[model samples]
Target: MSKSVVPVNIADKLSQFSELWSQKKVAVLNDYEVKLAKLKGEFVWHTHEDTDELFLVISGRLTIQLRDADVVLEPGELYVVPRGVEHCPVADEETAILLLEPAGTINTGDAGGPMTKAAEILN
Candidate 1:
């Protein structure tokens, strides 16, 4: 891991990317990674069998569509989708989010397709 004691500026880091649905790595905590992502529209319905996925809304609104319920999140709010549960995230407009999960967790989870991207570390 890159050594740095300075605090990460979320807004400054978020400004480095413009692509939607792509997760950019910001920090690492033991075996977990802290990520930032820009999301819009609805994501694929998927399940992370080995890890729980956390989504913290930074801007705009997000709706986590589960098999039987929907979790709505606004800025400064967060939700955790438990392991093995199928979920689809939706955003009506451009939304910025913080994600926390085990290292190497795929964005698309078990439903791998075109949107399965390995999170890139942001320098």
Candidate 2:
């Protein structure tokens, strides 16, 4: 078997990708993948049927919109969107975020709309 070394400094690795909304995967194990994302503007309103998504703000602010409420997360703050709960994400300015979710969780969820990303943000 070939052996390879995985590097440290996930944040530094994440910085290599400059595309907006594209998620750079830092690590993965079994059924989950840890990712870093740069977010701006508005994301589609949607929900995951089988998994909850964790969002941790690394820099700037992250706003999560629910049916009747909106939660704003600042740096060092974190939020989890429960499975099957509809939500949208918006950032007035550039924001850096970390996310943990099942490997196949879809960003657009079941509700596909104009804002749905045609491609999965993977690197």
Candidate 3:
């Protein structure tokens, strides 16, 4: 059963999953979906052609490499990668990140490769 309304504890919810580089859906608001992911090492280079992607770091460090620079994010830092921008994320160690994106936005984006996952709703 779903509650009419409640609170979302990002840190607590993030601790429920351990899969690296896979996004787990936690909730939805209007057309946006709230998700969490644990990442490690390097991820595939890709781009979202339709919508921008938002990344808010919850733990460790994540570096998003763009064509011109690498954006490093620590806990509490957030970045919004505009649609159609090519990029790759690298994590030297375990890092948890919160994502706010449009519902049905695939993790691997336009480049959809081996790491692509169909985000699953988490109870």
Say which candidate scores most in lDDT. Answer: 1
RMSD of 3: 1.6
21-110: candidate 2 lDDT, tens digit per residue: 766677675688788888999988888989999999988899999998999999999999999899998989899998899886666889
Question: Distance from true position, residue 36, model 1, in Å?
Answer: 0.1
Please give me the total number of clashing residue pairs in predicted model 1: 0
The reply for model 2, stretches above 4 Å from the true place, is 1-7, 113-123
Order the numbered candidates by TM-score, best leading. Answer: 1, 3, 2
Candidate 1: which pairs clash?
none
Q: Which candidate, 1 or 2, would have the higher TM-score against the true structure?
A: 1
- Of the pair 1 and 3, which is ahead by lDDT? 1
Q: Please, what are the lDDT tens digits per residue for candidate 3 over residues 1-123?
A: 756676888868887888888888898889999999999999999999999999999999999999989899999999999999999999999999989999999888888778889887777
Q: What global local distance difference test value does model 3 have? A: 0.90
Error of 2 at 103 (Å): 0.8
User: What TM-score should be assigned to candidate 3?
Assistant: 0.94
